[model samples]
Target: MAKEKIVLAYSGGLDTSVILKWLKETYDAEIIAFTADIGQKDELDGLEAKALSTGASKVYIDDLREEFARDFIYPMFQSGALYEGQYLLGTSIARPLIAKRMVEIARAEGATAIAHGATGKGNDQVRFELTAAALAPELGVIAPWRMDEFREQFPGRAEMIAYAEKHNIPVQASAAKPYSTDRNLLHISFESGMLEDPWFDPSATSNEEMYVLSVSPEEAPDQAEYVELEFEQGNCVGVNGEAMIPLEIMEKLNELGGKHGVGRVDMVENRFVGMKSRGVYETPGGTILFAAHRKMESLTMDREVMNLRDSLNARYSSLVYNGFWFAPERLALQALVTESQKNVSGTVRVKLYKGNVIGAGVKSHVSLYNPDIATMEADPTKAYNQNDATGFIRLNALRLKVASGVEQNAKK
Candidate 1:
């Protein structure tokens, strides 16, 4: 009889490392660890060696950064899917890509099961499992955190640390500095530990070391810098008049925005799993793109089209946040959003100063902003019809006047 094989999404982090070793010991299976490289800035360095040392049979580190930025990040950015009005969906967007790659590796390795370290309480477990279900339903999902044996064996971080120590696994677990963080190209998210307290005021110096993206706004640069972004069909293609790929564009904006101390958010949001959690995020490129894209839409998109898209933005955001990336509702809504952006070609000039993203200007070839029609200085006979407005206003306000008259009659 042969042992079953399972592919685990390995991050070389404490939790995933411990999970890797535990899966091998508990399942008596050949555990292959897979790590996706999504612009983590050398976080993947020596991950294969680390995974091997942590008891993985064979470690696979796939550089999926280009594909991630091109296929997933770009489209989501185009749709302007900001989770819960503040979160940039950084962790949300990265999960599917990672999960997809994990499934691919599983198939390649001929694994019967896939594994993840996402806690049972977080939205990431749903995101990872849903993606795996959509991509490779036949593969059994081995979630150790959800398993009674694993949960009882390692009740907390301390137990996990003890297990790692027994296995001679290298880990960063300690009594102090217990906050958890996830980082990728799109954004960095901080949660758990110290963030559990709603009244903790994340801005306080006690948590200053937790912020990876930037310092406080008070420490930001006093000078403002202007940058121009070029959009084609709602996707940002160029920055400051230089054409660049999706990933390059993001990198450029992130550098510029980070230099100026942009895109830091702190909020307590309702989780899909019936709990409120405090999350701090840094989305420099996303912040710039959102402001610039909205500004471009103002100049290029039709009034009714923009209004319709704006109405659905919240729904779309919710779907993405709640782990419905491959769901039909999100696909249908994305189709509508895509159709509306057909003429969203423009350039937006934005000023980034400290923590502010101010729109300086926007222009497009399909611009509906007619100075001739809108200018008060223009001749009324040319494009204006003052006479038509009298009947238009009267007809629109007739219901209000009738309601007022009825109130007066009732009073009399």
Candidate 2:
């Protein structure tokens, strides 16, 4: 009889390394480790070798930076998807893509099961499983953190660390670093440990130690810097007069935004699992892009159309935040957002100063703003007729006058 094969979404981190070994032993299965590269930087170093030596039949490291930025980040940004009106959906948006690729690998490798290191309490377990259920319902999901047996064997980080040492599993996690971090092209998010306290002040040290994408606002340069962003159909195409692809654009913006201390958000958000979780995110490029995109849309979008899109923004944001990236409603909302962005093409200039993204100017050849009609000094174009106000106001006030008459009659 052949050994059962299981595909593991491996990060080459402490938790995953232990899970890789544990899964293999528990199920008596051949473990195939898969790591998705979405701008995790040095985290991918020696991952294949580590997985192989740590006891894995096969190791697959995929570079999905282009697909991630272009497919996932751009569409979410186009929808103005922001969780709880604050979080940029950094970690939330990355889950579906990871799960999608995991499913693809599972099918290609002829694996019977897929496993992840996401905990039982967090949103990622839902994101991963929901995606798997939607895409590959036949594949079994083995979540060790959710299993009581696994939890009993390894209840805390110290137990996992000891087990790793005893089993000769090399891991990056340690007791010294209290919090855990998740990183991708869009942003780096930190949670757990001291960050769990809502009232905890990361500003004490400006959180320079934990933050990877940007410097602290206090540590930013004294002088403000101006940046110009070019957009086409609501997608940022270039920065500072240079044309670049999505991946390149994100890299450059990360550099620029990080230098200026532009994007750092710390908030206590309501999780889909009905618990409040505190998160600190560093999203330099995304912050700059969102501000520039809003400015571009303001110049080119119709008022009513923009209002409708604005109303859908929260709903669209919730869909993504709740791991509904593959849901039908999210697709419908995406279609509407894409339609709304057709004319949102322009250049927006912004000044970045000590965490502030202040808009300087915006322009588009297809802009709906009419200087002549809106000028307060005088309408030399004769576009405005002062006589028009009389009938317009009286007609608008007719209902108000009728309501007043009724109230007066009742009072009498």
Candidate number achieving the greatest lDDT relative to the actual structure? 2
TM-score of 1: 0.95
Q: What TM-score does prediction 2 earn?
A: 0.96
Question: After superposing candidate 2, which stretches have Cα over 4 Å from the reference?
Answer: 398-412
lDDT for each of the candidates?
0.86, 0.92
Kindly list the per-residue Cα lDDT of model 1 for residues 168-287, writing each as its tens digit. Answer: 888877757768888888888888787788777777777676677666666778888999999999999999999999889888888877777789988999888999889988888888
Top TM-score model: 2
Candidate 1 global lDDT: 0.86
In candidate 2, where is summed lDDT lowest over 10 consecutive residues? 202-211
Q: Give the root-mean-square deviation of each candidate in angstroms.
A: 1.8, 1.6
TM-score of each: 0.95, 0.96
lDDT of 1 at 109: 84
